[model samples]
Target: MTIKPLVIALGLITGSVVLSACNSTNDNKTPITDTQNLAAQHSDAKPVVYQVFTRLFGNTNSNNIPWGTKEQNGVGKFADFTPKALSEIKAMGVSHVWYTGVLHHALVGDYTEYGIVLDDPDVVKGRAGSPYAVKDYYNVNPDLAVNPANRLAEFEALIARTHEAGMKVVIDIVPNHVARNYQSLSAPQGISDFGANDDTSVTYARDNNFYYVTGEDFSVPSSQDYQVLGGEPHPLADGQFTESPAKWTGNGARAAQPHIHDWYETVKVNYGVKPDGSYDFATLPAQYAQLDYRAHYAFWQDKKLPDSWYKFRDITYYWLDKGVDGFRYDMAEMVPVEFWSFLNASIKMKNPDAFLLAEVYNPTLYRAYIEQGKMDYLYDKVGLYDSLKALMQGKGTAQQVLDVHASVKDIAPHMLHFLENHDEQRIASPEFAGDANKGKPAMVVSHLLSQSPTLLYFAQSVGEDGSEMAGFGKPSRTSIFDYIGVPAHQAWMNQGKFDGALLSEEQKALRAYYQKLMNMASFSAIAQGELVSTPVTTRSGQSATNVIGFGRQSESQRLVVISNFDADAPQTVSVTLPAGWQGNAIDRLEQHGQVALNNNQLTVTLAPLASAVFELEN
Candidate 1:
């Protein structure tokens, strides 16, 4: 909506990638009359997301003990998110900051000094617990606060600071489950804890917050050598925790003692689902799929909702009231889609533009989650991300990226794309691409492949290999369960200046490339452009399967993006431009020389694992 001339100026200074002037005639801006108008506003400005594990983002401590106490391996605090740090993040072209692990979760820390009871080590995952195993919905994690008693206030200050830096805030809302000891010490008056009013006599109840296994006490799993806190001697690590009438594990394990592989630290929340997985509540009508959130909220207003539904509704409202812009639901597919309809509808009614993203891996359920559940976006992990990963590892081809895009073409705009996240392996890891630069080509394609938001993990920009040998978190991922400092990212932190002052030359180049690509993608032309596939064909050269090409176009601007997937081979490929798309080529990614078009066809040779984004206009 706020079209600026700066994009055109930047484009000119950077070789004028496309020939069209940045300023567009009002005549060419067609009015959107449908609900898509709300979505279109997003297209005009590209969304760059920087995800940070709040506990690790600002921790300058390099003493990374695998299973050490918070004292041994320091933790990051809300106070660490200084204005200067946030400014640097914003300067990196980020629109949203996903502060992971901001909520109160069951952890191994002893907070008894602050009037909070100690978390049993047996039930907690590691020194820093899994953020997904939320314990208190109303309070911030005590570990993240500079003053343990002022944790919530500290979090609020961070939110205010993030907004001041022109970035929206996104926090996790793990709907599928909660810590086995589901107690909220800071719940607002008149609110009750989960299962407080439930009848434990029955195995299943329509209003029960959790499913019960009658006559059984909770017991620890027998197999697997893994232990809480890595088997460090502790008074609470005696392999026992108390739970009367054991509940089902988060992963739907019904056994009194779940297997070691099961999510033993958390218990699944029942959302009006019967023991047999049948719905016990009314579902949204098929006609409600296209309705706005207000309508969906109205439809459920007069209806009798489940207890679990009201609890989640209250939780989300609490955050929204605290200036939280949106939520990223964890393992959302495990919860029924109907519950999401109610939950998301309530949030949207309060804030119409709230960003609601969910992790739903079932490709079969992507559409249902987006349309029926009224979600803004769903992870395209199984589609776009998987295809790209395979192609990067030489196990697949560029044709697969095209195929995956075609499969999700109808919903492409609603799908969020990312090459790295806390859940995925780092692209630079030995198990992955084995080099940092390999991510360049993949990033160019991923960000420009569609008109959707792109996410980058905390250390991803600096080429953090994510290789670590920790007690809880597996190697090849930045440790989310342990108190660990990311070496590459810490260098960028540079003792709180956050200017990447200590980064290596290659690391600096990688970060610069990301900034350029992200800034280029932020231009209205690429952000709001309609996607067009311009497949490359090998002509009069050695045939190779290492190239991929595509284009995006607005009424006045067009950009052609091509990348060589092979790390060892330079590729030569040809693409025929659409009629009326003519201009001197400008390499938008690196601001290099032009590649002229002849007979409406253009050919380019790229260095190994290199990419090009060329702008074209008549």
Candidate 2:
């Protein structure tokens, strides 16, 4: 039932604020569901997210040559997401499976054998291609399917099986840009491609799908000492693409040939925002903040929208029909917030529980993006993730972490936390901590810090040192650009048994620790509890600067978490708990029974880079 815009305006004229149909938290209280309480016996856990780079997650090949082709290093397929693998992932305390790089992106692989159009090598990033450079919004990546013609069907089967394993699915939606060779062979009937209806003669237009450099041909930038596929000879790698009117680069570059530092593989999408940053779209009323998606949808029903906005709207609706539960929007801040309000509202009207996560980094715009854009969550990279990374690197202090919590306490639930992702340096890489065990304390803090969802990359559990320089550019982090198999993760895969039978004892122990912590975090208290910071001091009155402590409590339960961040020494730290909370502490991670908490305080010794979760007794 669509409410007319006229009726909405009349209602708005009478009432200053629209009411929310869903529960809007003061952003403080975290509520646990009965389902979570049932899982609490094993470990009261929050939402543990397992993010798999779809192309690389199931690859078991070990030939990690730089600039390797698919045949050389192997690619994971949708067929590899077997029922056994999904069950194992579910058993690892994962509530959601984020399938990254599922869409049809620009890649060097030939799919013409399946009648799919080929992307030009000059515009593609690497042999595997950048997932951000989307080529077709409506089709699944043929690289991920055993039979390229059945790509979408394979993905749909994966989605159904994921649900059968009691986990939700998340896929990326690269709304900010598309590859220079964007073409949608599988788009629904009557749907036009991006830039198909644009006025190419103008540099900027309110209705144009992209910003263009009028009367100019697109040229490859010569600034960087780079070549397509590291100068490997190919007929299509002749430093030429065929865009007659060159559009602006994805990263807002206005040059005919974008700088090497710019996002040259893709072209930016234009919302109604002009070059001067003036908006041409209708503004949402301030009263819309407290409104539910239905109200927001009703408010925008009769209004006219720009062509790009409608194109994206169609793209999202198409995915929703494919059994996708949510989207992790790429570079969402680049699109106008007004467009998001319309798009998200439309989506929520169709499926109100749809998860809408945005990659917005600017702290100042966080509130606006959540309230105005209706995003369910935003990456907490600039807050908790960055702080813990610095602390892990031994250049930051534990106090800075507390300061970060204080800064975002009001919006904590909406901040998604992670130590590693496709764009960030791996925790085991030299550029970062250079040790996978260092992630223990940081992961403890990230999961126990708030009621927010926690994310982990595929190999983070098994300690894949991200040193595979597989291609495209200088490599320190795991190569998302090239064909490479994560050695540690492949060991766990164990040639499709989906067991850690081949892992070293240390690797197996690391996986066990992750499972314990992640399952413990699933507890009701941690999932829905309020955080209270505890002072870290010892019985001898020595302040433990290398230790951090905090408590999570619900109406029925309480738990205290403490971690030692020092790299080489064990520390005995005393934590000052809240009044009236004294009990026998059971170590959730190490499984130590009955460490007493006397007189509102608990003192425990922790190994270097170790973390302990203490379940409090009455």
Candidate 3:
């Protein structure tokens, strides 16, 4: 199946495209056929991912104590994601559920009774710890299990439940690094721990799992503002997280004592890339660019690749065998692109339709990662997210949004659009737009403006403000490092009922709106259509500065979307349609009265920070 580029042209409109009325009584309405809706009918539905920080999602306890233990603050369990909870998520039009923090990571918790060593507070980020610092790649987090001995069974049950709810499962795979004390207790019979067989005396080796500093001992970073477990005393918080022959920091800091700001809790993985920025392994020829994952997989089958490559490949296959749908690779660009080519191809060979998403920020490396790395999607962060964020904050214009789309039009379909994720500030936070309602229009534009997968952070619909001062992570972004209850999400959770009975009227309305928007964006004609930038002008023929317009046309439907970014003022704008389009514009959103087209243009009146989706029909 050939995926076409989502076209975003400037001032160029195509020939007349006709669309039947959504509620037409006429017998001559055009019927959607399998050929016309092939993308939706033949392939997987355009994915709408709901990323839940698993440790925090089902925690009904609201005792958000700072640096508190799980006994004090409470941790969410895998059993908490009941059938009802998953049903509610599926009803929100989520095709995929990314369960974050499922793996066993280094944390300041005592689980010695369960055969897990107590993680030193000096190396752990918070009481719960950072999920990125993975300690055991082969085991699930014991804290999330009702029975620690059956943690893997609990995770497998969650996967089965997610699939039963009609949603695919996605989990994080931090390929660039692992916990400073990396160990794999549940590895297969023949498999060994990451650095168990390595020669620590060397700085770099083709087969070494980690890079070493030879003679230097690892030292804990020094900081005055930050303290181990917020200055509270603990046995392992004695200013020492022991390591002989110091390894490189996760972010490539080679110092024995990395800076306080560095990713000190994690250590970088070695992929046969030497110190002077040179590949020690075989590089794929330029001709491989046009080849498929099968060819890439075959290319590496005979080559002597690095041992780390095979380790990650084995890890991915382990999860795939357990029915995991795909992975969300963290910091994919930090590792060599060749490694991705090797890893992702192996994934495709196992599951041809696997959904491979990566966190790659560099625009220059986007094509290399997607085309060569065989990635299905990459974060559209630096481009679309940044532009939309600026527009939402009133520091950017509608043109900036259009311009960014134009810049990445060639790879737009592979670029996933998101407004909120774990790493980003919540739209309702004071540091952001300061109101949940402000995200409404921006979301419409972000979701509908491209033919890409859409991501919604958990509780984004109900307006999670991320304002809790939960231990190491402060306000503005939800704490991935602490155990805390999300107030807005908990209100919607309503004590595991999965119903919004306790939510405010405004939050309920916002959630309803999100449901409608997500459904339309995911399963409607907009999901697999060509996006054309529609020219917008005021009634007086001047460009509407704050209003952006675009058209999504599939064989089955034609839609004109107009959004007003102005927070305090309504705007009356005219949207120019294609030359031969003659129809009555029925407002799909808000259901204002039918808009009449005059001289190949449809005039719209939008409220402050409002959006309209006008479905045109004869």
Candidate 4:
């Protein structure tokens, strides 16, 4: 058996928030040896935190609260997510909880004094959705307030509750765009600074202005894509485009203007330009009544957003002082990298150990965001892309998966790795899981990627069935055509199965085996083991291309993880265990899969889409 390693809980100092952790006992009696030597080698070592989705102002459903909403339905009192949500997350042994969509909703005007209107589809999916597109930067969504407390008190209390739960809270930030319901645009109160645009230059800001649907210059008649909010008509270079009122699925996203609804909804901020290299907004307005008309939106060369443009910088210490652990940046790529570098430093100045996770979608290369250390950890797309590809096509060797992992390791936090998130399709589906008949290869690779931290989305542990209606921008419903079919929650109930699920009676046993494996390893160096690639037997065909093997070792812990990408047959793999690897090693994911050193020669049989985690027995 491997010796138990020492625990150093005070290493992460970027914005170090104290973690109150419970004793982590194994679920079953699987006395795995300690693997502490592994932690010293991981230069990118940090804590692994789990994230949960909570809806903002839209979802009022008492039982079904969408991911980003802050309020509960059929209830007048504010949604109390503090101790309630953190307590449940802590119960699962997770040290951190990422609470999404708790910010103030600047979307709706004071129709309800809270500024969040339930009528907008963008805010709520079919009247209940996760909050992504934001409107205001300050204040808490009134639905998140239990008492008549200010934004500061609510946030401070939330952080304190999280700390008290023996955990940390990672709030979401959207630097890309805000719901265009501009409290900032309203003259005395609104922020009308779009770069260099002037009051006379409103015509240059036509992209954000409104127009009539059939207004003479508008070409398309009834298509739902072209949106025209009510206000003033905007003239584009090609022709005048008008707005559509019903584009929003449920409520709205700057869907309607002051003339239409009592509540102010969301608006669409320009991403700076149209794709065609042409500036949509220019200094021109249509002559109303053959005389003169007002320009739609004033054009501003506001490419560089001022600090006061958004409340991101202003609200940093507010929550930090309240004792929130950190901020996991949402869409870090959307904003300039320079901005985050400054923010992360500023946050560190206040409290080190403030973790920063950037949501760089499908960024496997890691060159741009991860290497810079603009934030602590960025998303890993290697496993998600290649694993899904291998599972669906039943092609490629395990080497492909390893290559991606190695690449992901370079540019990203060595500790960072994730499979499924709230934004993507569930891993429990056929596309990434292969067929229901045999076990899914992607699922195994997800868990078997050495001891690196793997993120588990809320429904991922239980199982989230496929969605025909699920969309990246808009969350869709499950298609009746799919095998999982309707009745909704039933698919999730069977633990992600149409009929032939990925986890077999044998695989179910393996799942328990790995949970114990993770619990034991987390206490030692295995959580942050150093990654090193094993020499390839053949560098050529499916056999040559398919198998990918790598070993993660520290002073005490040595583990070899082999994942087969080919679906048809077992890939032949010969991985030699590295030297000085004296420790008790076992396959963390597979109970029977293990390799002992006979002059460091080990031959492993890896099934297609399956991965095995090996531990070194000293």
Candidate 5:
């Protein structure tokens, strides 16, 4: 099948969009497809929004939230937020609610002192580490399960309640590796070697698929690709931050440790082994191999895991019974396409409308997930990343934004958008949040022109100010490696920790404004409208990067957004309109003066580190 055109695409080849002093304007261009109308229609399409993750609602915690109990911070399903939290997100006009870590075991918890993950041997201790790394695919950790007393039915009830509340629950599914204490590989009949698993009941041939490597060429990736020479062996393995595991270590890919490696009980699956890169999906009861992996995947992939690990198509009765609206596969990169076909095909067959959000990142790896009808919308990381950077850097002009829209309109009208996720650094990573206006535009622009199915991380909504404490290796940001910024910069995070935000007052107002825009998009034509642009002229430089202005127009309504990208510059510029557009433009924000747009052209004045929006004649 040929590829579908994108709903929002990158015109990156139009050359890089850098904030500049001035550039020539193109007023004669009309894009091939009328995105303006489509965007208007799309605004009515609700965004399938999901949360980051929370692991405190485990069986042992109070209220037994599954990942954590009410007593244990009660934030159990962070992404699965409480009624109050749900209301907050719903207020934002969002759809899907993803209570991230709603699946089975794998000891979770990292003993975080705020943003900093303490040195626990295994890293999955009780301070709420990411819920992605699974411990047991079948067994839903009692803590997060709806009711530990009755795992099966309770789990069903949770799903039912989520549906009743008008939201679909999405869980995390990892096909890479199982818990280190995986009962299948540690049994007596097991050879303590390949081919024989802990279950001892099934041989390696029948146990499912995984690759095991015996030697070390193990290179751990800790820093950015450009900065780091190569992936290095973690000097801090499990929990021993002091000692590095050198030479060829024992055969345990990842294992269960005491205080050291307590949190995660996983063994990373080897994607490189079984050379020639062959992965058997051979046929029948071996269509069964694919089937088994699917069954395992379904368990931890939602907020409410099923009581038992059952086959995929067969699981439909439970899904309808549970009232689930979708499934978002985790770590989809490692799963083979042939195997994934059944997943998407089966779900659509079961309910035709089940939304599938696969965690496949790379284009080559996620192609099948996107094109095969396997997923309604796969997460587009680079696309989201680029759009976010463009706005934050104050470079995505009206031309830049529309050029992007023209490109991706058909590829997938609805794609998942994001800034920071559980796996990456919180946007507050000092390296990125270098702004005094508190980085509000970063958050605002993301949700504003983003594709549908947007993802908002834990601290993103509130502009939670701070940095990542579980920063995988770099003990410090500098040579001395001391906790200087944490205590002083983030007093709220009294520890040597930082908040996950940097939103300014204007940025906050902008965020509220865009949020309204998002809601308008949800029920209006903004999302599906045909996109058109109006250009604004401004000088850009180190202090003037903040000066940006542009207009996005839909058939029924035409709106203009303008802002100063630079935090330090004070300046003004002239803006031009589309060929047929005309009107007395009104500034959405209080501005000093107004410009008369004549024959589709208008000269306007702007302030430093400030923005304004104008509404044109409908």
Candidate 6:
């Protein structure tokens, strides 16, 4: 499993859009036609991503001490995702299992005997540490293993288990930044740590792994009211974490002492991008936007890229060889799109069907990242997620969802939808809708609105409120930074049985609803169908602002979906069907009486925060 580092010297390489046809070199590649492309695009079931915060998923420890140690809180191991658990997750119609925080990260734990270096408390976020602050790229987190020495093997077994359960494995790859004390103890013999060969005298070098703040020693940021371990005493809590010639913070903060709000625990990786916002590497030609990943990979084959680019690419290959299916790139927009074009092209060359999902928030950059950067999917955070959140909080109307969907309709299939993730506030939280039921209609819209992947955070079904004041992570979001137990998720775990024996009736019903919706959403018609937004109006002909109507049509199926956002009142609305849509509407969700249609319009009544999927039968 050894990867030889790219030994290209520093040199400027210009890129051109190769408009010429792909060379017929016998590289064992098969030419794909237009029909094949379309068929390949929709060949599989809709990807239902189940994102589980790895360490917290199976942790049965009810002792959720704020900023508690792994010992006190009892951290879950990679072994906890047993066969039963994977089967249960697969039963939810999940196509992918995102094992978040699988990488070795800077954590407040002692593994000195295992030859792992101790991370200073000042730089570490919580007891378990922020998963994004990756300390090593070549190894799994020791805290996640039953035996620290066999951590990587344990993770490999987990990957196998996930695959055996008929689900793909997705892990995080924080390419934009890494831990402030980045040290890859498990790196292969030839691979060197980042900044090892760097000329730190200059602020920005073309090949330097990180941007150095020359002549300035790094200083720990002012914590203000926040204490390093909740004011608890520890040897490393002496307010001193050393780094000479400080590198820029992960958020691109150039200060020697970054603000407390800045991502001070991690340092940004330089991908041939200068501090003046100029690219140090060759920028992809605008014409290259129309090219495929293979062409993109061919273009960069001869070009000398930045060392950081090779490093991340090699890291990706390392995981791919480990049988890990795909990656969820963090803060992908922060990295240069050109770099993605090169790296993702290389990934595609190795594994064409690899699932590449990224966290890209800018609506303007969506097309570039997807079409040019070769990303399979990007987070629909700023667009659909924000609109849905506002609607749930009573601050917006259902029209906003339609508008947001319309804005990115061209690339809707590449936009991944989600109501909750590790970063977002839980729907059951006081700061959010404060009721799990409020997410029903939103989930319906998110899942069925487009031909895109849907991410379901762990315990989102049983309604985890995320109300615990878990150290650095405040209420409303599950604590990714600390060692804590998720009550709702634990109830479903049922002591490793992976059954919901301990769940309340409401919780049980919510889980069942999620399972049903997920399975239905996986259907070929709803998953890969073309969507047509239908008009919805009240009986009096006024726009039904609280209701949204849309139709998903395929060669084999035609379905109409309507959701009521209003949480207090039931609304009867007239949905104008697509032209030439003539059929009996059968309720797929509730199996209610047939919906009557008059003059191409169907009238339906929906309770507050309820949704219906009507299968149009000819």
Q: What is the C-alpha lDDT profile of model 1 across 1-618, one tens digit per residue?
A: 001111000000101111122221111232211236335536657677789999998788888778877787788999989999999888878888999999999888888887777888788777788888888999999999989999999999999999999999999998878999778889999999988998887888989998888999999887567766776798888889899999888877788898777788888788888876567777778767677677778888888878999999999999999999999988787777778888988998888778888887767677677767787878889888999999899998888777777766656667789999988889999998889888888999888876678888888889999876656867888888878888998999998988889999999999998888877757655677777767588866543466888778876778888999988978788877677667677887874468888877778988888899988646
lDDT of 4 at 338: 32
Alpha carbon deviation, residue 417, candidate 5 (Å): 1.9
Across 408-463, the per-residue lDDT of candidate 5 in tens digits comes to 44444445667656544445455545442434444434444433556765444434
Instruction: Report lDDT (Cα) of residue 463, candidate 2.
Output: 87
Ranked by lDDT, the better of candidates 1 and 5 is 1
* lDDT scores of the candidates, listed in order: 0.80, 0.80, 0.83, 0.42, 0.42, 0.84
The better candidate by TM-score, 1 or 5, is 1
Clashes of 5: 101
Best by lDDT: 6
Report the candidate with higher lDDT, 2 versus 3. 3
- The better candidate by TM-score, 3 or 5, is 3
Name the weakest run of 10 consecutive residues (lDDT summed) in model 2.
1-10
Summarize candidate 2's per-residue lDDT along 500-538 as a digit string, tens digits. 999999999999988877776567777777787678896
Off by over 4 Å in 3: 1-44, 522-524
Off by over 4 Å in 6: 1-41
Runs in model 1 with CA error above 4 Å? 1-43, 541-544
In candidate 5 the C-alpha lDDT for residue 467 amounts to: 37
**Can you write out model 6's per-residue Cα lDDT over 1-618, one digit (the tens) per residue?**
001121211221233222122222111112211112323545767788999999998899989998888878878999999999998888888988999999999998889999998999899988789999999999999999999999999999999988999999999999988999888988878999999999999999989999888999999999568898898888998888899999988888888998777788989888887776778777788767777887898889889889999999999999999999899999887888888899888998898878889998767677777767888889999888999999989998888878877777656777799999999889999899999999999999999888778999999999999988778857899999999999999999998888899999999999999999988755667666777767899989999887888888878888889999999999999999878888689988764568867789989889888889988887
Report lDDT (Cα) of residue 243, candidate 1: 92
Error of 3 at 150 (Å): 0.6
